[model samples]
Target: MRRIAFLLLLAVGASALALSPQEGWDLVAAVESGNQEAYARLVEAYQAGDPEAGAALGVLYLNGVAYPRDLERARRYFEWAQAKGSGWGSWGLAILYANGIGVAQDDQKGFRYARESMERGYPGGKALYAMFLIGGGAGLKQDINEGVKLIQEAAATGDPVALNVAARYLASSDLPGLSRDPKKAREYWERAAARGYFLARGFLAYDFFFGIGGPPDQKRALELARPLVGFEPAATAVWATALYFGQGGLVQNRPEACRLAKDQAKLQAGVATIYGLCILEGVAPGERALGLAYLALAAAWKHPPAQSLLSDWQKRLTPEEVNRAKELLKNLP
Candidate 1:
């Protein structure tokens, strides 16, 4: 308990007041655990149009802290906060655009909004803007040196998002002038993950689980990723797969795994494959027809494993089942 508390404190420190790691958890606990005092304070503050209060609510909706994930709701709240001139809200909207959460991916809008947030003096916004600058995304002029310098500045102030952006760039490949440094990349990623940066946590989980940059450590992957089951796409898929197959030192729990897979389905074909297989086996307590439909969905996304599974599964189905599954797929919104 002491260790966890210490780590939480460290995470809070790294967020630099702009992207607070503690934003949702404590607030959500206060609401869901029925702490009327805390709940009333939040309600009053929000009713009084406090931007921080509004942004905190937006974070709760965005991250599904003690609630069902609802990206549209999060977007609404973020918009409200942004209207009140909260840079934190701008940062949140940038994240939504960058990740296509509850909206179409629009790098131009993302870049514009992230730049706005940075200009408004938000630390997280600086990191976000630098991330876009690093890639020169969406017609923005590439400024690799400027981006790296900005990230270094933000990281010195302990901005976790800045750490994540730097680590991601270093880990991916050698840049035009900068060489890849695996050890530094690992350290930065681990620190950002511990500070609850979504991209860092997810990326680190995938890399560690598969040995992309180093030796695979399945146990470490699960340990880092379990908290992101409903929050980060790739990490959730990794954790759900581990649970489904009893791998990574975890016992099999197909029902739970399928639940996570279903939440993240269609985002990645791997998630669709897991959910489809689980549904077929009744672990998801779903119709075998629906299972085939999901596999078809995955196949449409061009996942090779899903295509193979779909082909193999279709061979065992009657023609009627195949028709029903295809019809269901067509009807899915």
Candidate 2:
């Protein structure tokens, strides 16, 4: 959902200082010291079209250095730099749009901007934009195949998240289109886990415990899960499920499982609010809560459970009600 890194560079010739490489470093020091006059001078240099000055101005605006926070201005400066064909500008603008920081959220805009940066050889932007494409289904149709390819492109450029996802697909036979290859999957997942993608580690635990992709190794599974339990509620739930079932490498630990499940359930309940709201909107076709049909199709696209529930409800609804739902879903994203 966001870009991963920042670069620090400044202009020397435009600053009207002794033109040396260290001049850029000196301007950066001035910014860090909250010297407004020096900061303004640097900004003026940027206005004169020095790429270094532009980059420095972008940093100042982005960090609120020696000035009030102004993400809108930062976004503008980034746009200027990007127009000059700098990767940083494109990367910065993509993040701003993706997270709705300096502009309205526009997933497609963010996706295209990020892709542009990546195409310009920005590795971090490549991974981040690909993530937006995968999660937001922006620009591209919601094709899991294309999403996987974008993710692979990011992984090729060394994005840990891409690696984590690829590893998960290899390990799990659950991914939509990838062939099931246990050994290859194990290799990818294990490599990602070593690099600290804790989710991949947790998935590795599942694989070892279930022996779907490899020989059962409960102890190794627990070893992997231990580091991941606190990272995500879902991960915690998996660990608890393992303990509850006493099937994974862990010895039966029901008390621990019960405690963890209770905690995890609370988090899940909060997420269920989305589903509940969709039902309230009458998008679930047979939503018992709201009789009005506003957007049944949205509910179906959001989840398989909603689709199944809507199908069941449609069987009992009158023809008029069913037709209304069909219309609503057709208009939904």
Winner by lDDT? 1
lDDT of 2 by residue, 91-127 (tens): 6777778767668998878888888977876554665
Provide TM-scores for the models: 0.61, 0.42
TM-score of model 1 vs. true structure? 0.61
Instruction: Kindly provide the TM-score of model 2 when superposed on the true structure, using C-alpha atoms.
Output: 0.42
Q: Which stretches of candidate 1 lie over 4 Å from their true place?
A: 1-48, 176-179, 207-220, 240-245, 252-333
lDDT of each: 0.74, 0.56
lDDT of 2: 0.56
